[model samples]
Target chain A: MSKQSLGSLLIGMLIGVAVGVYLGWVQFPVEYTNSSMQALAPRYQDEYTVMVSEGFLVDRDINAALQRLAVLGKENTPDYVQDLTERYISQSNFPAIPSMVALSEAMGRLTPLMEVYRLPPAPTPTPFPAQ
Target chain B: MARSPRARNGIRWLALLIGLVLGIGAGLLYTWEIDPVIELNTAPWQLNPAARENYVIAIALSYARNQDLTLAFDRLRAVAPDRNVWQLVADIACERHRSIQIASNSDIIVMRALEQLYRSQGATGCADGQYPTPAPIVFMTPTPTSTPIVPVGPQATKTPTPDLPTPTVPPPVATTPPTSDRFILARVQSFCDAQLDGVIEVRVFDARGQGLRGVPVQISWGGGQREQFYTGLKPGREPGYADFLMERGRSYQVSVPGLVSEPRSIEAIPCEAQRDGQTVTVTTSYWINFQQQAN
Candidate 1:
């Protein structure tokens, strides 16, 4: 309440604030993890799987696909696949439906609702005469 | 001033403690809640694992519709930063499909598109089956067949006197193929070549390595990504050397039509050194010279 007390309080407050800022911002800063897919959280794991599925469709390589999915951790992998396929089914995502069904079947969870086949080969080409 | 010395000291310590607590509280509040570190416009590489996957999926979808490989590559590079990005993309797509989360048309197309893009760029992955590219559509014009009609008119008897003068004509000299018209895809390379600077330098040359001028060359990246160029367009440069600038970080397949071998596509790989001290750079244009033997 007195002048001496007020002056000391103001000076102390200034010093305290500078120390606090230094500790929070400089000493112990926030560190980010999960910068790569391998460090993905549970919430994002399904989405990453779907992207991986799209990549599989592109390359059509089953072995590589399995290897990449191996990083999802052995325990949660099957459940994750099941959940994603179920979500796709609920949404009726047609483009991914067949492939997802195929994947589900591979995971030993569900049968494909429909069968898709590759295009038939074309007729033999007629040889052209040499010029 | 009227207070005792001990009491004053006690009050001073109390003030200092209160100040310290209040200051720490305010600092923590400001830094953690109100004005925290914000990563604005986070580059693809800076994204979390989940977000990076989403970004790669978007790139695959974009590539499926537009097939802009150069742009796709640039985007992939941003996310990957290190390691082979296409292989990463391929692995991701394959895993998702294998996991059964991809159950839509766009997802399927994107998967195949991602595969094609990576494979074309020489990266291999596991999903290597049944997603064969649809056969290219080619319209073949059929030549109508007609039966040969037998000559019905009576044949006239040939005279015997014409045989004497038929042997007197001189033989014609053989014409050779033009030097500029016969460029082969002998060394089609894409790099950060300072001389090339990311342009497709279609150099037409003879076996002697002399640059031929004014030779027209066509550079195409499939999907209607085609352009025409001619040598000598730069005046001072060799008459047979022309340049077409490819957007940076793209896999390009150049063909001289009749001259290129089938099933051949080349990408401008990142190179560290070149002949002499000239180095490859992102902005430096490059040359894919074609040489033909002189006629």
Candidate 2:
């Protein structure tokens, strides 16, 4: 092959390689899934229901809801309690949900009950009422 | 001997190929090593909205169960790199839960919860220091009992004729001043004005007209909003007693545990200033009240 033709072919090959690499490495795909929150388990169904119910109560009477929860704590709360709380929180039912400090205390009281009822620990507890 | 033109062109092509490789290498190095390091090192509060929102939701969901504000705040701060703390809280609350709305009307629910907490704790004022306040006294009423005081009373009365000294009972001393009856109250002055760049402020004072220090204050506005602000004695040009940025015409309220006698609200108005021959207007508002003394 002529030297000029060889040079031209080499340059074309280099450009193609560079473009290919840039397209392969530099391009990023947009992630559309909300992968943060995990799916709820069946065992937590009752707890989720209660949480939603309490959340509804919080809209009208936060004090009453708290009182009810406190009373539930004194007794043997059901496994569904945690699920309810989570559901209510997820639904954003409480207008002025207690701060993390207060929520932690409430959860602390509920933890033992949850244990007795044989409910599993929530997916993320550190930031929840426990923090 | 004539050298082919093609042979000479090959040499030029080799030089150009080398230059292109170097340029591409330089670009890759800049993007990978330098750019990524800078982005990774950026503060959590500095993250973009979508990332911040995700972090907030995660932290809030955890906080809802834990109820540990300091930890929740720290976790949230780590995820949300560039935003203000209060603003972050509000965003998280709004995003994760429908109940924690961040609009003006929702302030009442937050204030009411805080009020109940303080009342139950028996906090006299929102002041940072300890002060005397009355505690509820449960006194048992004396039960009436019937007993037969037989002949022994007649024999004792005959010997007791000697003069009996007058009984004296000193009056009850007042332990606290009348002004102590006043309670410290804190309320949101204003919040979330686009013009003010999304800031909120809270004001606190005792019934005796003194500024309270070190009292934690939280302001909740917007439906599904979960923002919280703390109060300190120091005066400054930021949210909390000194100054705050808020959008004009927005409604807000404030809450201080054990201080606010009633929930308070405020609507922001524009304040005017002049700088460099130009008139500048800013929006401001406040919630104010005296602390309720423990009864």
Candidate 1: DockQ? Answer: 0.16
> Candidate 2: where are CA atoms >4 Å away?
A1-3, A15-131, B1-9, B12-54, B64-74, B92-295
Chain A only, candidate 1, TM-score: 0.50
TM-scores of all predicted structures: 0.37, 0.29
Question: What are the per-model DockQ values?
Answer: 0.16, 0.05
Superposed on all Cα atoms, model 1 deviates from the true structure by an RMSD in Å of 17.0
Native contacts retained per candidate? Answer: 0.35, 0.04
All candidates' lDDT scores?
A: 0.59, 0.42
Model 2 Cα RMSD, Å?
Answer: 17.5
In candidate 2, what are the lDDT values of residues B79-141, reduced to their tens digit?
544545545454343443444433432234333322232322222223212222334354554
Task: Tell me the tens digit of each residue's lDDT in model 1 across B175-206.
Answer: 44344444455454445654555666666654
Error of 2 at A106 (Å): 16
